[model samples]
Target: MVFSKQVESPITTEFFIDEPTRAKIEYQNGKALMARGPQALHEHVVFHMEKALGRALPQMEVRFKDVSISADITVKDEMNLML
Candidate 1:
């Protein structure tokens, strides 16, 4: 199993801005956690999940790892209601 790594040293917003990474970085409660790139298995799972969700809930939109801020997956209605 894989888990996100917590940054050891305290970091400022400036440091986070200076650092560049393709992986996602999440900051919360004075701590920073970096997410690893999705593995092949993980991608496969997410793809299938999205497909199934799209079929089952045709009226809703399904997104995976596309939110600008902090969301692994999001399913929202046409009116953009967060569920």
Candidate 2:
């Protein structure tokens, strides 16, 4: 999901199940979710594109159901913008 072409929509806290240490997140249609798996490669690409054009997405909150860890994150290509 590439969101480096427009402004980001306001995102709020998200709820997920299980630990997300190695889990990968995919965003689409203004929705964010954590998949079960490692995302080192995906992160490598995204992190590298931090300075690229159209890469400024909105920030969202992440919470674990297992009480492991939580933090604020930005989701790319994960929001529907109006006007």
- How does candidate 1 fare on TM-score? 0.21
For lDDT, the strongest prediction is 2
Q: Largest TM-score belongs to which candidate? A: 2
lDDT by residue for model 2 (12-82), tens: 33222222343455556323432433454445344446547445434666757856668999765736555
Error of 2 at 64 (Å): 9.4
Report the Cα lDDT for residue 48, model 1. Answer: 49
Question: What is candidate 2's TM-score against the reference?
Answer: 0.22
lDDT over C-alpha atoms for residue 67 of model 1: 58
Whole-model lDDT per candidate: 0.39, 0.44
Model 1 lDDT per residue over 1-83, tens place: 23323223233211111122334445463233324334533433443464577632123335578556765887777898656
| TM-score for each candidate, following the candidate numbering | 0.21, 0.22
